[model samples]
Target: MGEELKLLGAWANPFSRRVEIALKIKGVEYEYLDGDIIHNKSALLLEYNPVHKKMPVLVHNGKPIAESLMILEYIDETWKDNPILPRDPYKRAMARFWAKFLDEKCVPALWKYCWSLGEEQENAYEEACGVLKILEGELEDKKFFGGNNLGFVDITANSVGLWIVVIQEAGGFNILTPDKFPRLCKWAEEFRSCPVVKENLPPRDRLYALFKARFEKISGSKDAELASRH
Candidate 1:
């Protein structure tokens, strides 16, 4: 057993899940504390992540680490068993490339596709597919992004599927329909079947109801505000 590891996370966030999945893969014992950084965050969150003031701060041995990718590296380094990073130097670099790619480039268009409601939404919808096309190409012949068994890239890439499903519902489009991205769709099924991920996931139907309610609430507010102008 090691010193206590605590994670401050938002349930719906893929950024947070990146760290969570790494922790689970490492078999490190940790306590997860959920928060709504959108409103009031925990005192520990503020103290631990004074700089970023963000959720998904990983506190290990009372020291805090921020940023999902950085925290993952820290976890990998701290725990020798069940390493998340591939041993090969080139593969490690490629893994980080994909992780950063997800953090930077992939998320924005995905968000816009789910939330935008015009030509802008249409453009972002296309952009999201373009990004998925790149990913599908990368995964074409690979078992996982690290090539054999699960590694950092596999976890990070699949974390985005949470967003993909949510976006599919929000945008009224099935961007990841099994027929279109068979590999990805199959990967999603297998990934979720993993005990750590499958057990940790919020119940799908319950999550759907919560997301639907929030989506309708926000959209209704926007409609009401727009109508008041006329």
Candidate 2:
């Protein structure tokens, strides 16, 4: 064998899903270690990503790469068969730009949804919507951000949708209502419905229970709905 490839990730993370999707699209076989670091982090996580110590660390041939975006580029370059990003220098740079926008602007709100219910929570919700709205504008007549197919930006931006329903229920907020953002709503539907992504999604009930419990902990008896579960 050439070398063993491994991925350390948590189930609910969109960041982690980026790496997972890239691997699948590339047809790269790898071992997945899904242990949430929010509660219990694995030694592999610490050893692989010492600095930020975040999840979705890809270990290739014993060398580790931290940060999901970096890993996305590495995956694209390493396995060039099913191209995710554009080949042209300018187009590739543009894809990176949009990916950066999604990573920075939209990803955090999903995690922060729970434990926030006041003005701060409200602001977070709006900003999150605003981020998606920007993308909607950019995708005016395009099927995918990559133009014809699901490209790097599509996978990266769509990662956050994994826990959207859970985050909404846990945080007691709704930003991407099916009625409000039709384009985005449709895009989310298409994104998840895709074979590669649909295959790897976590169970809804499991994520709901997990997020609800975590939400209860953070807000501390503030959420009446979760209290009903008790």
| Candidate 1 global CA lDDT score | 0.77
Candidate 2 per-residue lDDT over residues 1-230, each given as its tens digit: 57689999988777888889889999999999898858776677788888988898999999999898999999999988998989999999999998888877766654454346677776666667777678778877677777868889988875555577566776677777767767666777777889998877777788788878877776776676678989
Window of ten residues with lowest summed lDDT in model 1: 158-167
RMSD of 1: 1.9
lDDT of 1 by residue, 21-138 (tens): 8888888889899998588767878899988789889988888899888888999998889898987898889889988887677776666777766677777878888877777777
Which one is best on lDDT? Answer: 2
Superposition TM-score, candidate 2 onto the true structure: 0.88
Tell me each candidate's TM-score: 0.91, 0.88
Give the alpha-carbon lDDT of every model.
0.77, 0.79
Query: What stretches of model 1 exceed 4 Å from their correct place?
Result: none
Q: Judged by TM-score, which candidate is best?
A: 1
